[model samples]
Target: MMRAFKSLFWIEFKLSVRAMNLVLFGLFSPAVVAVIIGVIYGAKPAFDGAGYSFMAQSFGALSGIGICATGLMGLPLALADYRHRKILKRFEVTPVSPGMLLFVQVAVNFVYALAAMAMVYGICRMFGGGWEGGSFLYFGLSFLLVTVSIYSLGMLVASVAGNIKTANLLCTVLYFPMLIFSGATLPYEVMPPALQHVADIMPLTQGVKLMKNAALGLPIENAAVPVAVMVILAVICVVVSIRFFRWE
Candidate 1:
């Protein structure tokens, strides 16, 4: 099973790179948005008295958002295309299991999301950003949890979607509502009570919360709920994705 999974991972990774649209869409969009937001917010601290750098927070938020976006949107689209092409069906005929395929897809996307995160963090640091001490473990785990959760959701999307176009459309429609309300673009504190209630249920919002806590070197207790939510969502997604996944 381990060997099968590794083989599938390489195959999916190659396919991901070959699909230039997915690569560009995943890599560039959030980068552009992060740059714009980071530049604007990083220019001046929201309150000079707070002794906080707004760019650091913005960068952290951007990293979480970027990872979630790629894991959720880009991954599903690629898998949908594979399903549409009968690639999944072809694999079904082989000794490789659906579980292997799904795991590979998730693993490959996690790596991509991590790479994107590294790029974002590097860019921020190059521009004079700094991190609070004692946050490395929290940040690492939060990022890992969020990435895995969203990657599983993308697999769920691939399982349910009929084709690449439908999957792309569904992912797009689902993305903004979640993203906007997820505290990535707008502060959760600024949201109305109803909206905040809605955002609280969203995985992306939980992701943002985790990222922020990590960036601030806050205690892990502050991140416990979000981490739990992400884990639950990931489990649900993986189970449902397997239950409904179609070979052809």
Candidate 2:
């Protein structure tokens, strides 16, 4: 089983890489966005009275771009399309289980998101004034929580969507709003009061807030809301995904 899983994972990894458009986007889009924002805003205050610069405040949000792209869209879409085509059904007769296929898809998408995140951090360190966080450890914890939450949510999407078309529609509905308004692609600090109120209710927005607070070395207690929200979201999504998972 271990050997079969390894072989399956390798095949999926190669397939993920072959989709160069998506692979490149996931790997470098965050760095590209970072360059544009860093050039425009530099060390300027993110907003009036905000202690951090725009670049610093945006680092956490920028890191989430690939998460939305892969975890929220790519992962679920790939899994659903496979199911729609009966690829998973073939695995049912083999030693490989449906759970193994799901795991491989999740692993592939997680790799992309992790690579993008690392690139974002490296670019930020080079040109985005670096982070003020006193400890990467706590920031790592925050990143882990956000990643798990988003991917678990993606798993739920795969479990529920009956076909590629449905998955695509669902992803569009969820991804665009999160990508546009969750501060992943925009400056959340400058958003209007009403929009900020709405955006704050989003899990990704809360995750970004959790990340930002950690990056700023702010007291962890200050991020109680986002932390709890992401934790609950991850748990609920994972449970639901497992309960409703479909091989067909």
Cα lDDT of all candidates, in order? 0.74, 0.81
List where candidate 2 sits over 4 angstroms from the true fold.
45-52
* Model 1 accuracy (lDDT, Cα): 0.74
Q: What does candidate 1's lDDT look like per residue over 164-225, in tens digits? A: 88898888876887778888777776799998998888888888787876786765565667
lDDT for model 2 comes to 0.81
Residue 223, model 1: Cα distance from true site in angstroms = 3.8
- Candidate 2 is scored at a TM of 0.90
TM-score of each: 0.89, 0.90
Give per-residue CA lDDT, model 2, range 139-236, as digits (tens).
78877888888888888999888888889898889888998999898878679999999998888887877777778877666577777888898889
Model 2: per-residue Cα lDDT at residue 182: 93
Each candidate's clash count: 0, 0
